[model samples]
Target: MKTSPLEQTRFWQAQALGDIEMLHARYVQQRFAPHVHEGYVITIIESGAQRFWHRGSEHLAPVGSMVLINPDELHTGAKAHEQGWRYRGYYPDTERITGVLDELELKRCGLPIFDASVIQDPQLARAFSGLHCSAEHDASALEQQTAWREAVLMLVQRHARVRGTPLPGHEPGAVARAKELLDSLLACPPSLEQLAAEVGLSPFHFARVFRQATGLPPHAWLKQRRLGRAREMLRQDCPPLTVAFALGFSDQSHLNRQFKQAYGVTPGEYRRACSGH
Candidate 1:
């Protein structure tokens, strides 16, 4: 019932992206006031500990743990330890993630759940941090908007599974995991060699099934995703350099060549024309 200064100040703030926010909170503060947001909540505790009230009980959020809160669910963040807590969160619009699930033909999971402990997943974290930074402020002189979208997509493709569950006639198995993995990592990407290792399939076999399921070659899928994300970033006021690097291109020149080839416009020229120079 009672809240502290950190609690009130630590609440969610609107973001540039329709469905993202960076929540700064302290440990052992007041309850989240039984509120609901229009999007999903993906939070990573930076330090200290947190106790979130939801589902009729308190959930302990230790540093390193990933918290996935379902959209429109009632929840709150407070301290669980003496030191306090800091978190990087992405409150993505339900439709954004759901659209991807629909595109992937995935069924929706009723509610989101938390992993028992924090995962050793730098990729997910990278995607999350990028989302918050971009959403917090519009691109200034030149920041990377493209990179931000890339991260958000990566987070969605990789971490959105549990949230969306599976679509009808979906087969749950290792092959499923492989598909999910590919969706998450679309840049700098991975070779069949390493990818095969992840799913315990021969590269050749994996390729076959991947094509069958997604109707696209592995490498091609990665490129399409990266380019698609890049295009979204170009719509924002972010710097070209950041976009190029974030999309896994060598640099602006590299991005220029590929981008023009793909979409018929250089990143800078496109942003200037679209978002305003």
Candidate 2:
């Protein structure tokens, strides 16, 4: 893709907790070469239109429609309108998605698959759009988490093709040990590999089982734990910067960003509110 001074592609790991990445881009002249992502792609078009080659066919996803690209599917993207296409997208791994599905009592027959590449559902569109905004703007953790689950549930229930079965059993003892280690070292948690080793499992296996037990991956669980601790300390009137250091955050802004994401208010504002301001 040739870089145009006016073209914009803003990509970031989604600010919310989960195994998700985000892209909010406006592309005019850029054409994406054939590519594949290791995770499922869910996107809602904001304006203009997109022409994409998917599943051996070319398709159009215009404004107000959602695009579903299954994992490892080869696809290409290019503008379909003069104004180009503006969209917000989320790429979530299979494990994270399955975790969400399990919450809804939906079974992953093999892997949840989508037959339609382009879908026009106002409800799903609104749900995904809201999730994208909440994640981008650091909405409350509860809000972001709720939006994510709701959107995924809606999508899977309505669009996915999967057989009905119960989620797998969890290793409660192993998961508990892992949680203990995490809580014991809140300031400097171990790497995923290291944690998995300590818990006597491979990293990938640990991740899958951990999500089964806790409804979150290790990294996201640790983040939420830290943020939760930050909230307790903040309520006690601890200095935000000091709390940041104690919680092993990069800085107060790091703590602030997370705090806002969990509480829908910045640390300072939260402090003032707690002080009866």
Candidate 3:
């Protein structure tokens, strides 16, 4: 359940930007420790089954199903069946989504894990696959972004009715403070003490309360965001050292270490794989 500061930033940031790391678990026992994120989590169960504990409920997401988690909600995930599961997820920021909704003249909506009769529709499935392709390939940047947004918006409209309040148990104002402070430092990451002070919580209490509200420890969650963004930049063919610098690492070497540590491969390897070199 422990993750380095660098990894924390990578994970959450990636989700904020619509970059998802595909996950396929087979007979696995992994805990999605408690913490909140700054983005939405959209997942599709491609095969097998999984259990999602969210908003004080357990959802069994089976094959050919989709799950959407609103920003800053407390949730946990793991395999629900013996054969385990395979799934893909997208993490998109609420702020960005709201902007799109405004453009489309749709009201802002809550994070919804909608169950739809049409989700299994062949047309919708094809659209979903195409949108997910945009997440993986670079060819249709604008087209895919638009398509992805539309797909999500429609899903929200169909299934997500406003439910409870926003998450992390902190006043919305206080939680926003934490996000602001975190945004300022993913590289040379801050100490928990400093972060807690910024968010107006004692460190120990912050860890417990924040996780209960968000589903991950503050630090571990943040690293995932940073790693996600770092990967996107690297995919852009930016110099590895530059990617490190932009994301707030000590240097390329430091970035490489953390990148490999979190991703199970070197930065060069990641870039090469992404570029299909």
- The clash numbers for all candidates, in the given order, read 7, 0, 29
Q: Write the per-residue lDDT of candidate 1 for residues 1-277, one digit (tens) a residue.
A: 2334553222233433442334544434433434444566677777877786665577887777777666535555666777677777655666655555465565656433444323446667756655555555544323434555465456555554464555765753545776577657655677788888898888998888777765556776666566657766876767888888777877788776656444323567656644533
**Per-residue C-alpha lDDT of model 3 across residues 1-277, encoded as one tens digit per residue:** 3433322111212232344443222324444544344566666666677786777777787787776666656566667876666665555556565666677776544534334211344455556656665555554566766786777677666666654445664455555566567766767667888878877888998777766654567776676667767877887777788888888777888877666544434677667645646
Tens digits of per-residue lDDT, candidate 2, 177-237, equal 9998998899999999998899899999999988887656887778777876776686678
CA lDDT, every prediction? 0.59, 0.78, 0.60
Candidate 1: C-alpha RMSD after superposition: 18.9
Among these predicted structures, which one has the highest TM-score?
Answer: 2
Candidate 3 lDDT for residue 213: 52
Q: Please name the candidate that would achieve the greatest lDDT relative to the true structure.
A: 2
**TM-score of structure candidate 2:** 0.58
Clashing pairs in 2: none
Candidate 1: the clashing residue pairs are: 27-79, 28-78, 28-79, 107-166, 107-167, 109-164, 143-239
- True-structure lDDT of candidate 1: 0.59
How many angstroms is residue 144 displaced in model 3 relative to the true structure, after the best TM-score fit? 2.0
The model with the greater TM-score, 2 or 3, is 2
